[model samples]
Target: MPLWCHASPAAAGAAHSEPALPLAGGNARVSPEVSAEQDEEGEGDGRRWSSLVPELLADILRRVDADAEKWPKRRDVAVCACVCRRWREVTIALVRPPLHCGRVTLLSSLKQPGPRDAPLQCFIKRNKKKSTFHLYLSLTQALIDEGKFLLAAHRNKCGFHMEYIISIRGDLSHGSHVGKIKSNFTRTKFTICDLQPQYEGSKVPSSSCRPRLASKQIKPLASTGNVETGKVSYEYNLLKSRGPRRIRCSIRCPIEEDTEIDPRKAKKPSTPGSLVLYNKLPQWHEHLQCWCLNFHGRVMVASVKNFQLIAPAGAGGPWGIQDDDAVILQFGKIEDDVFTMDYRQPLSAFQAFAICLSSFGSKLVCE
Candidate 1:
């Protein structure tokens, strides 16, 4: 029952790429119908669209949320949601503890633990840069819905605090692509890290080009960070591919620690770092999916989650991945039903990976 669910699923896909009202760096939510007329000299439509602040503001929030994983410069989605009165009311309410009945979005049947029954907040969305922690909603929660309609609360703890990046490479190095990730990621450690390049048009070398199905499904990993984050981590590298290449690095990390790729030090749009690792992990030819490992070096992602990785065509770059061959996670049983919680494995599932780039993870990089 989407705005146009009757239409083909492809139609929804079209909406995603439909020149979303041509918004720029700023989050300006102009109603689609009115946005086109914003530049016209005063008179009717221009003023009318300008007057419809609520509609425009909503659209702006929608767009900002869509790109939250990419151009991340803020903490609160409310920053985008509160551009207008209507959004402010909605966002503020969602953040309150013991969420009200109707403000939730994706939690269809999740049962929030009562203060007495609720588990102690084992996880917190502590935005290090923001100097705070958001223990309420999650990116998935926000993506599920922003409107205040459903009311049930679930017991979804904040998962890991990392993104699993799958990459493809074209640079013929001395070692083969298959290797242990421990040595590569001396400092950082996650389920999957950028190890190669992605393709744009064609698959690279032996790799295929298959964009991941739902990169957004990647869960966050839990973290009790150690003492090694201060080391000099090498910057992500970008390379131009001779042919098409694809890479799918999907891992679960945490939302608490905002450790993503910075575009300022990145190479090209194609040379995206931690940012692109979001839903756009990558997909490729046919239906081949990449892989990851657990702490004990056992493959995971398949036994637990419902996600896979793919590579886009023409995805290659100059720099090598920081943790190309990192270990995949070993997630225990997580009741799909958030209402009923379990505690077999890591309480909070955060995605991580080991790359050959720099020293990450702890505060004082011993290496």
Candidate 2:
């Protein structure tokens, strides 16, 4: 049995032997003799573990960290840290390393930053039965079994286009709707616009709750939009991949406010401040007969529905050279019908979400 499974027999015996300090007549007391015996046993149990040399404890924790690198096992490492102060310190030391990077990184980073603001974590869950998908956001790393009820996107199918009804606090039943994401036939481009603001305290929309741009249109401010007209405010473009059966995608946001197309240009002209999201395409395996994405191109067995957003390395268009070290956003598949998203500075939850939606559906039109 593992050390964490059950307490030492001596500790259990000590616990049972201790006198019950009960409150009676608004007073609580314990016999001095029993209290002293309890104290001695408690001290003995503490000393047994605490007496171990710091090096030995650290060695044990290092082994634990190495062993729990997978999904379910990783959760155990989190539980181990909560055992006691000494264990917590050791775990923190091993998990977080000194770094001179952005304020945020993956929680699983061995050299993660010290406790600061918790990074935003989002997951995509698709419901094939309903022909719909939902996007969820949470502050802590969690498995779907943990239940995510923060901000969410519920899908509504409309012909060739799909609409994502945005709601907050799990208001799927009767909550006032907040916004909608409309996906076009190209299946790459999407526009997010705010619906009417919910009246105070009522689940029903106010009489003015038309699907128009509210007085203050609400969307992820991370990526700005180029054009705004009535209820339709933001417009973003999802560029098609260059190769067939490729898992990669490119996104351009806040396209030039000027709508005129330059027919003479071979490629789309990138606007001055336009941002691009790039997905590193995954390769197909001959033996597995399935397309996959893996870290560093080695773990080919794992399915990868993931990508990263990057800015041009220098002054260039969306298709220009990319910086090798800069990673603005990171997202990938975590489990069946679920995916994980982690982003650094300048990327808002809403912007991260819009980029992720471009990942859905097949890009190959002819098969």
Candidate 3:
């Protein structure tokens, strides 16, 4: 029997034993002693109220886990666990791999894969210019966080700050150099190049943004690059949107060296790698007055504050088709200004990060 259960019988006895003190009105009377015993029992009941059956509690926790996975950000689980001791124990037992098991504050916490089994946690702070962001990538789940100046970007002197140069570097002691990324902005397109070191010393022409071609001619665009290979690894292109605040994306490998020739064929032809496309553009919300990214055309949230990257359905075989729209990336807002990015395999930490960074700048120019 529970502690509250033992007190319940005593409370009933106390209520019966105490004599009623008659009042001046009629038959109504006050039983102070009985009331005191009942009050004590009520407090005990309050203490035991949360002692629900373990199986039922576990089921509730599973629902919470599912909801957390559905969220663009992973902090929902952390918030659920923080409710009370019972909830904390339940969540700790139910949450599985890839789910962060630490306390999250009102600061941006970027969770990516680390060298170790644990996921890397990165915090970001955008500079006042909206041109640069200070990043801190941690080795452990918590502790010893610092300012390493991981990345920065300078917007070209153009409307919308659409075109800019992004640089990713090592710490001050480690060389102070890594690579650069360039974004091409146009009337109907936006493109991000693979990171390359050669771009570090290249100067932007004073009239780079000036219109040089006739209205009907399309201008050629340069690709941005990274330092790891100094060559184009991947190219991400943003196509013209059909309507306001909407866009589509396509990603392809920079080099397509995979070629094969049959004995009867005259020459071997190279085929490009599979093309990855991002669509189902988010819509502008009338009530919120902001663009909302819809998950499965169901759950919707402000796009500027948070969004996700998911693989389109039907690519996988018949058995795997159900999970076609699975999430590949999750971005969420922690504070008013800070946000996080989490991505899965086939994408390097840098690559996943670059994709998220692409979402930061203005898109109205392309529309």
Best by TM-score: 2
Clashing pairs in 3: 193-224, 194-224, 194-225, 194-226, 195-225, 195-226, 196-225, 196-226
Give candidate 1 regions above 4 Å deviation: 1-163, 166-367
Ranking by lDDT: 2, 3, 1
lDDT of 2 by residue, 80-119 (tens): 4544556556655554321222222122231121111323
Model 2 poorest ten-residue lDDT run: 228-237
TM-score of each model, in listed order: 0.19, 0.43, 0.39
| lDDT (C-alpha, whole model) for all candidates | 0.25, 0.44, 0.40
Candidate 2 segments exceeding 4 Å error: 1-119, 131-148, 173-175, 194-273, 283-304, 315-324, 362-367
Give, for candidate 1, the lowest lDDT window spanning 10 residues: 338-347
| Per-model root-mean-square deviation over C-alphas | 21.0, 16.1, 22.4
Per residue, candidate 3 scores C-alpha lDDT tens digits across 1-367 of 0011111344333333444322222465532222456446764232232354778657655664564432222344444444346755665556542223332211111111212122234545555564565454443333224423335444454653354354443222222222333444432344555433233346433346433545543222232224331111222234644443333334432222211111112155432233353433467689988566644322222444355554456542321224555554555555544555444432334444555555565444433
For lDDT, the strongest prediction is 2
Give the candidates in order of TM-score, highest first.
2, 3, 1
**Candidate 2: which pairs clash?**
97-111, 213-231
lDDT of 1 by residue, 1-367 (tens): 0010112344333333343333435654444344445435433332432344655555555554444331122233424232334443433333322222211222211122112121211112222342221112222222221222111111111243322121111121222121112223322333332222233443333213332334432112211112121111222323422112122343222112111122222244332222122111223335445332222221112322222121223221111213322112111212221111111110111122122111122322221
